[model samples]
Target: MAPYEVLYGRKCLTPLYWTELSEKQIHGVALVRETEEKVKVIRDCLKAASDRQKPYAYLKRKEIEFQIGAKVFLKVSPWKKILRFGRKGKLSPRFIGSYEVIERIGPVAYRLALPTELERIHDVCFMCRCCDDIVLIIHM
Candidate 1:
């Protein structure tokens, strides 16, 4: 039984049947055809929406890779009342380095030669958090 039949003690009215109808009044073959048509229409609409969204989802994304010994700027997240590398405030820089890439830990992670001040923090960072020093010119 459908949830509506269990909860309200009656079958729910669908788009095809706004009024209550007995099982004898509806034919199985016709109901199956209508349901298949509705499902096809819903699937087509979902595909259209997904296609329209695909380009924007990848607009700013590109494959990023770095070799060992390459220089990169590491992105930093600021926290309230907590200092990072002795810098704090709304005006502080969002990224720090030209840190050398010591090793490529994985496809998307790189280990950097961070300064002694940042020894407490982990050295491995994802590609998104590290920007190539050469590409920094494009933004300027």
Candidate 2:
């Protein structure tokens, strides 16, 4: 079993290593058990793997070989208010439009040349490619 597997609550052990734990500190306390030394080894391996995992920001920057005119989509994230909070009625728009890559400012942000109609709401929406062909558009 991988180290992080135990952290994620996977059936990653022999019956001997399994033990009931309180819901609050379920995984945390389970990891401290003296008997599960082997499991601890697995946990260590998993932790190493997790630590080695690239950060979201770094991963997003690797998405595209940006060209001056490559077509790409912009993603909008839902907003939540800290005070007087209620769900915004409008469903968050997905794949709003395919805008051309006008210029690359930094790894994650780009200068996009958008339509004049969308100028009021958006002219330059910063993007981060979190996954393959998927850019998370950050409102600036």
* lDDT at residue 128 of model 2 (Cα atoms): 35
Candidate 2: give the clashing pairs.
Answer: 3-46, 4-46
Model 1 CA deviation exceeding 4 Å by range: 1-55, 80-82, 85-90, 126-140
Candidate 1 lDDT by residue in tens digits, 55-78? 999999776888888777776667
User: Candidate 2, 47: how far from true, in Å?
Assistant: 18
lDDT of 2 by residue, 63-135 (tens): 5556667666665445522111333555445445567788877656677777775565454564533344665
- C-alpha lDDT of residue 22 in model 1: 62
lDDT of each: 0.70, 0.58
Which residue window of length 10 is worst by lDDT in model 1? 131-140
lDDT of 1 at 50: 100
TM-score of each: 0.46, 0.37
Give me the overall lDDT of model 1: 0.70
